[model samples]
Target: MKHQPHDAPPGDPDSALAGEAEGYLLARAHHDQARREAEDLCARMPWLTAAQAEDVARHYTRKRIDLTRQMLLSTVERASQLRQEYETRYAALRRDLLKLHAAGVCAALICLGGAGALASLLSR
Candidate 1:
């Protein structure tokens, strides 16, 4: 794959995908660098053939894949932690709201009783 960095400037119509485009360019550069190194190694060592160079590239690719997988797993773990914290805060707010509602109901009932008592005294 061929990719070049900074093809689209910031604020360009395609800038929204700049991060992904940059990643692709970086990955391509890394692969090309590795391939060149592998070729040089094969050239320096007469016994090592093209097949050995291919194997070296394959090994590096596998290492990169493993590292990406680890990063993704850690991200998932972080997301789970955030979700738990949000749930705890939501539950606390719900409890506080319920307490406030109960207090309001009690206050209304006390006022109604006081009004009824005042009316009876006035009638007598």
Candidate 2:
């Protein structure tokens, strides 16, 4: 028997939406943190000694930026994975819908053909 739409065994709408929303929020937060860190690095650079100031400032900014990039990358990767999963599900649903439509068409044709045959036999 074909599975019913309402009877989704798993990956229901609420859970999926929640997961996506969470990922988006995380990415946003990570981006904000990174921006703040960059600003701090710039503001503090002047106080640093000339001997190793540039290097130290660069290191601080680089570390924060790298971590932010990583966080955003992970968020993007998760979102990509979610999109792929949804695409796959939609493809399967489309296939099933087409099959159902074809079956209905075949049944109608069969019924008409049978009726025509019966009428011919009666006329004979």
Candidate 3:
């Protein structure tokens, strides 16, 4: 019932790996482009001190890092939620299976006792 992310295909391992590789390439390209743009900014703005240009570049890098951090936190939260849901389902299934096993044992014992009584009556 869980939906696959836009990057990955569902149900096929090879396609999923390919999708992950594609996503990595795309992210790498984006980072490269951002770095190039930052360098160009520093090159074009000669009036700004070198330190100030570096600061500008750092600002962009920090923003990107912060965005990645937020995404990671969201993914962790989703994982925790899924873990809780699975635990709850497992507990319910275990309880039901236990009840079913007990019922079966009880039925077998009753049948055995009835057979024993019938055999005794036939012998008498």
Candidate 4:
């Protein structure tokens, strides 16, 4: 058996580690992209002093990160809503199917009872 870390919970440490690693990689990629965008913005206006360029880069990076965060939050909220709706619809459909099945069974039993009664009357 493989060993688990004492601080970790009972299941699948590998997946947890993978998720953390993926998050760090994405954060790094976003930072790199923001840095490149900031550089491009600074390059467009060559007249600014060093301090002014630095300020612009800082402001641009902050705004970009905030916008990305807001978009991710909105996407997560929408996904949650869709999951709830699909689950409710699935439950309703299952209930309808069960009701139909029960009705079919009852109909079959009634037909069998009528046939048995008819056979008894014919014999008499």
CA lDDT scores, all candidates in order:
0.74, 0.74, 0.81, 0.87
**Candidate 2 wrong stretches, greater than 4 Å:** 1-56
Instruction: List the pairs of residues colliding in candidate 2.
Output: none
Ranking by TM-score: 4, 3, 1, 2
Candidate 4 TM-score over all chains jointly: 0.84
Cα error, candidate 2, residue 16 (Å): 33
Candidate 1 off by > 4 Å: 1-49
RMSD per model, one decimal = 8.3, 10.5, 7.3, 5.9
Candidate 2 or 1, higher TM-score: 1
Query: Of 1 and 3, which scores higher on TM-score?
Result: 3
TM-score of each prediction? 0.57, 0.53, 0.58, 0.84
Cα miss at 117, model 1 (Å)? Answer: 1.8
How many Å off is the CA of 52 in candidate 4?
A: 1.5
- Write model 1 residue lDDT over 16-58, tens digit each, in one string: 5666678778768766776676566556777756788678657
The ten-residue window of minimal lDDT in model 2 covers 1-10
Residue-level lDDT tens digits of model 2 in 79-105: 889999999999999999999999999
lDDT of 4: 0.87
- Over all chains combined, what TM-score does candidate 3 have? 0.58
lDDT of 2: 0.74
